[model samples]
Target: MAGHTHRQLAVLRAAAAGHVEMTCSREPHLYVDGLACCDPTLGHQLAGLLAPEPAAPRGPGLRVPAVLTAAGQAALAPSAAA
Candidate 1:
């Protein structure tokens, strides 16, 4: 399983339910419906992390699945209750 930051964990929890995005609230926060997407910077970071690494060559990117794969579910499990 991937080691996720607290922010990443929060994002995964929210996103697990559906697509995640920033809100148009006065604070300009991130959210998905009733849930708030915590840590705007990390939210964007996690979004980048979730994207499949660019086509393989000699590069320094962690290979992540295009979608929330089984590994991702495992990563989120430990933090879901919080």
Candidate 2:
């Protein structure tokens, strides 16, 4: 919430808005095509944001789920001071 990049904040906001499904993997990559936007992370960061952890599905494709939590929603909120 304090040090995440603009991209990182956008990723979480997208998830909260149900704009796209996130698939965090070992491979460092991000996706954006039309209305489809994929935010790929190192898995650990997303794990900290969501709960229960993502499943370790077989194969090379990303198969984990990344849903925004309460704190995540707050992160997207505008600061009251601002």
Model 1 local distance difference test score: 0.48
lDDT of 1 by residue, 1-82 (tens): 2556666765666566655544322233455554554455653455433433234232333222233446566666755444
lDDT of each: 0.48, 0.50
What is the lDDT, from 0 to 100, of the residue 13 in candidate 2?
66
Q: Local error of candidate 1 at 40, Å?
A: 6.3
| Cα RMSDs, all models | 9.8, 5.0
Candidate 1 regions with alpha-carbon error over 4 angstroms: 19-31, 34-44, 47-67, 79-82
Model 2: per-residue lDDT, tens digit, 51-82?
32245453444544456677766666787114
TM-score of each: 0.38, 0.49
Candidate 2, poorest ten consecutive residues by summed lDDT = 28-37
